[model samples]
Every structure is written in structure tokens, then in C-alpha cells.
Target chain A: MAPFAGYDMPISYPTGAVEEHNICRRGVGLFDIDHMGQLIVSGPDADAFVSHTVSGAVLDMKDGDARYSLLLDDKGLVLDDLFVYRLPGRWWIVVNASNLETDVEWFTLRAREWKGTVKVEDVSEATYMIAVQGPRALELLDLMGTPKASSCPRFTSGEIVIQGTKNLFGRTGYTGEDGGELFFPAQDALGLWEGFIKAGETHGIEVKAIGLAARDSLRFEAGMPLHGHEISPSINALEAGFKWACDFSKPDFVGKKALEAIAAAGVSRKLVGIEITGGVPREGYDVVSPSGEKIGTCVAGMFCPTTKKYAANAFVEPQFARPGTEVAVMAHGKPKSGVVVKRPLYLPAYRR
Target chain B: MKIDSAARYQASHEFARKDGTVFVIGISDHAQEALGDIVFVELPEVGKTFAKGQSFGVVESVKAASDLYMPISGTVTAVNDALGGDPALVNRDCYGLGWIAKVEATKAGEFEGLLDAAAYEKEAGKD
Candidate 1:
């Protein structure tokens, strides 16, 4: 166990991160993600308030639908990347645990300024979250009495009952595999954790307890960005290639004007994929040009278990952003030659 | 984790035990367990010399990379090349197959200063 975001969380099980990562890729894996933050945004002005607060089209989403979104500061810098769910009569926003307090403050301040019946409530302490992810994830979940979670398409959220209690179920996950996330009262954490483990054994299904270590690699292999690394207050959508999550055509939002102005003038930096030739690249490593001048920084990098290559994400000058551009990353105290590659390193399994 | 009675241990988890005329050194089982899954180990070249507490190499786990410190001042005679292909041997048998290096000790007196198995276990237990 390790301390993360003020919570004592499991980093991995005894089987190790490599096996746990393979289990999620080839078989099944379970994640205890209770540390994530869940918030409730409700009242008469919810529809407009949500659309105004987030960059995604939350107003158009049908009840029980969810979509990826982001919160930006007034200067168009990323505050946090989040998932916004349109449930019954409220907006459910799930965010990174590290940014939970900041998000609540941002939303509460905005709601008060916009002033209506809209309400913001932090329900994270009262709830537990877990993810069942892998190629065979759905098959194992189907055995439960919960009716047809498979029927819902990806990114849909609804309700399912386990042990006679209703649980919030979403066909959403952080890993690039096909899977679902479950949300319930904190008291149900242990029973559900054991129940899934038992089911995996009883049915001869392959299941592994995935921790934060494997979770990071799983997302890294899929070429997804973690907030504090790839997208943070210092890194914006314009530089991170995350403009797809922003809707410039939509009406006035917090950062809409600033993003439009920045996009028109063009961005100075670009986030590109780098493959180290002789070693693993790591976050904060200096990305140097062939002439030995620093041009950029490595956002994240490691030995991708699935790819068997040392891959990294870097923010570099636009001239060096093209595929096949040669560069070097300072790894383990030495500069290792590398080249820019076409992204993403790997796509989500569903797309394949 | 069991401490090898034949070896003397540094508080940082490295162990040194007399082999024929040299000392064999490696990290303790408790160190491997705390490091989780190790993916790569940067081994120093043969014949490299270091002070009693200098950094010898680096151990890269799935989570982070940590430096391996020299348990006693010596000239490295051999390195466990097997770690290049399988670093998890350290986690499996830290004291045996995972022995990191064979060093010709220049300061044999430092070995006597390190904690013995019973003493090391008592110190590690406090963690």
C-alpha cells in the first residue's frame, strides 16, 4: 500500500504489476478506485449550468449518458479532465481525487455567481467506485443478476443491483479495454470486492487485483494522458492535441474565448510521441535536439509492457513534431537517442 | 521476509557476505518486496570501484527507479548479468540468484560494523 492524494491505496497485488497489466489486456482485472471524486450538480438550471461549466456538450446528452470533458481556467489552461454524466435529473461529474477540492471550489463559485436553483454537493466520502476492466470483462459481469449491462453502449450510465442493492453502473473505464465502472455506498466496498473475486474463481475466470501502478501503465500503453503529467495548468488543449474535447462552436463558456484566440494565432508547442532507442524515457527528462540544445520536455515515458518498446510523450517545438524527427531524451543520467513516432502508441482495444 | 544469518546488512537493505576471498552483495528480500515489481536493473561495469556507501547502480521498478548503494568499499569483480533479462530474480531469491555483485573488499573491517541477521531483523521490524 502507498499514500496517494491523502488516501492509503493499494499500488498493486502480490502477483506484480506486469502480470496484473497482462491480465487486464488478455483476461480480466478489477480496480478499487474509491479515491476518485464524485459530485452531484442538480436543480432547475442544471442543463445550462453544466454546459456552461464544462467543455463537452453535456446539455445534449440523454439521461443515463456520459462523455469525456474538461475544465479550463479563464486563460484556457487545463484545470482538470473529467467525465460528465447526465443522469435522471442531475449532472454527475467524476474527477481525479487530487483535484476534487479544487473542482468543488470552482463549481461552487461558478454556481453562486450564475445563481439559480443549481446545487453542488460532494458525495465522494459517501460512495465507493470500482472498475471491472479487460477484454473478457463483460462476460464475467454478465453472470451477475444485474440485467444486461452489455446492452448499454459504451459511455452509457445506469443502475444495476448487486446483493439486492442498487449500484450506479457505467460502461466507462480508464483502461483501454472494454469494461464498466460501479459506484455504491462505502459500506458495500468489501462485499462487492470479494464477490467479484469469488465469481472469477467459481467460474474459472481470469481476474487480477489491479493497483495504481498497473492502472498507470494500462493507460500509458493506450496513449492516454494523466492530468498532472500531460494536461495541467501549464499544458493546454492547444499544445496537448486535446482540442477534440472542446467545442468552439458552442456558446459562451469560461475558456472558450481564450481558446479561440489562441487557436487562431496557432500554438508554439506540440505534444508528440517519442520512442527511445536504448532506454526508457521518464517524466521531467530533458528532450534535447541533435545539436544538444534542449527543445522540449518529456511528459511521461516507460517500458510499455505490451509494446516492448520505450515510448514517451513529449512537448516539443512544432518543427520537431513530425514523425521520424530525431531527438534524444536524458534517461538514467545519459542521453538516449530517440525518434518521433506517429501517435497514439496504441489505440483502445475497442477501436481495434 | 527472512534475513540470511550468514550475511551482514546495511540499514538501507543491502547485504554483504564473504564468498571465497571476496564479498557477494545484494538487496534484502524486504527491499524487493517494498519495491514491488522490478523491470530493469542498471548494472555497473566489472572492475568499477566505489566507497562504502556510494551508489553502484539503479533498480527500476514499475513504479519508480531507486539507486543501489554499495554496502562496503570495494572493487567490483563481477556483476549478475542475468538481471538484464530477468530482474525479478531479486524478488524471488534476493540472497542467492539475485546477488548483484562480487566485490574484492578493500575495507573488510566495515563488514564487521554492519548489523547481523538478528540485529538487522530488529531494525527492519521497526519499519
Candidate 2:
């Protein structure tokens, strides 16, 4: 186990990261993601507060829906990426574990500026999250007779009962596969995890506990942005290729004016997918052009278990971000040739 | 977990076995286990000469990359070509099918300075 976000987290299971990654891609894998922060926002001004703070169209979301959104600073730089789930009377915001305290403080301060009633509560300690991901994930859940697990569509959330425990089930995951995330009382975490494993066995699906290593590789293959690696305080949503999450059509929002100015000026750098030909490219490696001019830096790089190739997500000049554009990555002090491909190196099989 | 009794070990977790005049070299099982999933390997080319303790290649796992050092002064005779396509051979059988290279020993007497299986087990436990 390794220290991550104040929690002793497993980096991989006994079978290792490769096997765990294969399990999630081919079969089913379980992830204990309890370290993620959960915040509850409700009141008369809840919808207004959410719309004002995030870069998503929160006011248009119906109940039992979830939207991927980002919190940005005044300078239009990202503070963190989050998922805002609209329940019956409240909005549940899930943020990165490392940004829990800062996000809570940001939300609390913003809520005080509301003219109507608005209350923000940090419920991270009382909540636990588990993700079951793979093509067979829903089949295993169906065998378990989990209510709403099979019916929930992508980016949707609903209440469900698992092993007699009430929980919030969301059809969302980091891996580019069909899966659902379960959020329930912290006390029922172990029971639900064990029960799901046992239920998977009945359906011939070998559900194995996955660790942070596989989780990272799976998400990286899907081209999902991680907080510290892809999007950070210095990186904006436009450059990170998250313009879809930003609802510029809204009248006004936090960082709206600055983001509009940035959009008008055109983004300087763009995040592009790179396939390494020679060696693995790692973070902080310089991306160079054909003429040996430095272009950008690699933020995340790894050997993709699915593609069986060394791929990376890098920020490079807009001219060098097009697909099939030849670029060189400095690996082991040598310029290894590669090409900038489409944004997502791999596509999610179950995306609707 | 299986250590060859005939192989001599280095404190850095490399193992070398005398096979005629050429010595078979590879990482220990413990080293492979510590590296998690072996993904890529950068092997030294044949005929590349290196002194004792010199870095000859690199082994990368899903977690990080580590340098592989020469156990003794020798010239590379051959590298395991199978690992170029299937690096997991090191994790499955670190001592046998996963052998990294065969080297023609320049100083045969250097074998005497290497730790035996028993001494290696004792030293590895201290880690």
C-alpha cells in the first residue's frame, strides 16, 4: 500500500497491474475509490449556486442525471474536475481527493454570496465509493439483483439497494468501459464489495480487486484527464480539450468573461495523443518538432496495456496537435519519433 | 521465489550463472516481483562490453523504470530476443526463460567475489 491523498491505497493487487487491467478490459474489476470527496449542496438557491460555480449546464439537468464539469479560478484556469449529480432535492458533487479541503472552502465561500438560501456540506467521511468496471459489469450487477443498476444509462444516477443496503448508483467510471459507481454509507463498504465479488462468481465473472495502478492506466487509455496530470491550476479547460463541459451559452458564470477572452484569442497549446515508437515517454519530457524546436511538455505518459504501445497525453503547439503530425519526444535523453493522433487514444466501448 | 543454487548473485539483484566460458545473466525473482508488471525492456546490443557495475540496459514496469547493471566485466554475447515482444517473461520466469543476456566473461575470477545463493538470500532479507 502507498500513501495517496491521506489514505493507504493499493497500487495493484497480488495478481499485478497487467492482469488487473486485462480483467477490467475483458471481464470485470472492482475498485475501492473511497478516497474521493463528496459534497452535498441544497436549498432554494442550490441550482443557481451550482450553475454559477461550475462550467456545466447544471440548471438544465433533470433529477437522476450527472454531468461532468470543472471548477475554475478567476483566471480561467481549472481548479478541479468534478461530476455533479442532480438528485431529487440536492446536488451531490464529487471532487478529487487531493482537492477536498480546497473545494469545500471554495464552495462554502461562494455559497455565502447567494441571495437566497444555500447550504453546502462536506460528507466525504460519511460516504464510500466503489466502482465495478468492464463489459460484463452490468451482467454481474444484474446477477446480484441490484435495483436500477441495469437500468441506469450512461451519465445517469439513481437510488439502488445492494445487499439490503441503500446506495446511490451512477453509470459512470474512469475506465473506458461499461460500468457503474456505487456510493453508500461508509459502514457498508466492505459488505457491498464482498457481496459484489460473490455475486460475480455466480455469473462466471471473476471480479478482482483493482488498485490505483490499473485505474490510472485504464483512465489514461481512455484519454480521461487527471487533476494533477492533465488539468491543474495552471491548465485551462479549453487547452485540456474539455470545451464540451463548458456551457458558454449561459448568460454569466464564474470565469466566463476570462474564458470568453481566451476563446476569442484562440488557444495557444492543445492536448494531443502521442504514440511513442522507440521508448516510453514520461512526464516532464520535452516534445520537439521535426526541426528539433521544443514545442511542449508531456503531462502524462504510459505503456497502454490495451493498445500494447507506449502512448502519452501532451500539450503542444496548435500547429503540431493535428492527427498524424510527426513529433519527437525526448526519451532517455534521445529524441524518439512519434505522431500526434486524435484526442482519445482509445474510445469507450459503451459510450452512448 | 526460486533461486538457482549454481548462480551467483549481486547485491543489486542481478544473477549470473557460469555456462562454459559464457555467463547467463538475469534479474532475480525478487527484483521482478518488486517491479510489478514488466512492460518494456531496453536490452544492450550484442558485442557491447561493459565493466563490473556498469549499466547495460533498462527494465520498465507499469509503475516506473529501473536500470539494469552488469554483474561482472564481460562483453554481451546475446540478448533474450523473446523479451522484445513479451516482456512479461521476466515476471513469469525471471531466472530461466526471462534471462536478459549471455556475456563472455573477461575476468572469470570475478565470479568468486559474487554472493552465493545462501548469502544472497541472507542479504536480500536485510532489505
Query: Which model scores highest in TM-score?
Result: 2
Give the TM-score comparing model 1 with the true structure, all chains together: 0.91
lDDT of 2 by residue, A7-41 (tens): 99999989799889989999999999999999999
Model 2 regions lying over 4 Å from their true place? none
Residue B18 alpha-carbon offset, candidate 2, angstroms: 1.3
* Residue clash pairs of candidate 2: none
**C-alpha-based local distance difference test score of model 1:** 0.88
Q: How well does model 2 score by local distance difference test?
A: 0.90
RMSD of 1: 2.5
Clashes per candidate (backbone, < 3 Å)? 0, 0
* Chain B, per-candidate TM-score: 0.97, 0.97
lDDT of 2 by residue, B2-121 (tens): 788999999999999998889999999888988889998889999999998999988989888899989989999999999989999999999899999999999988988999999999
Best by DockQ: 2
* Two-chain DockQ for model 2: 0.78
C-alpha DockQ for predicted model 1: 0.50
Instruction: Report model 1's interface C-alpha RMSD after superposition on the true interface residues.
Output: 1.6
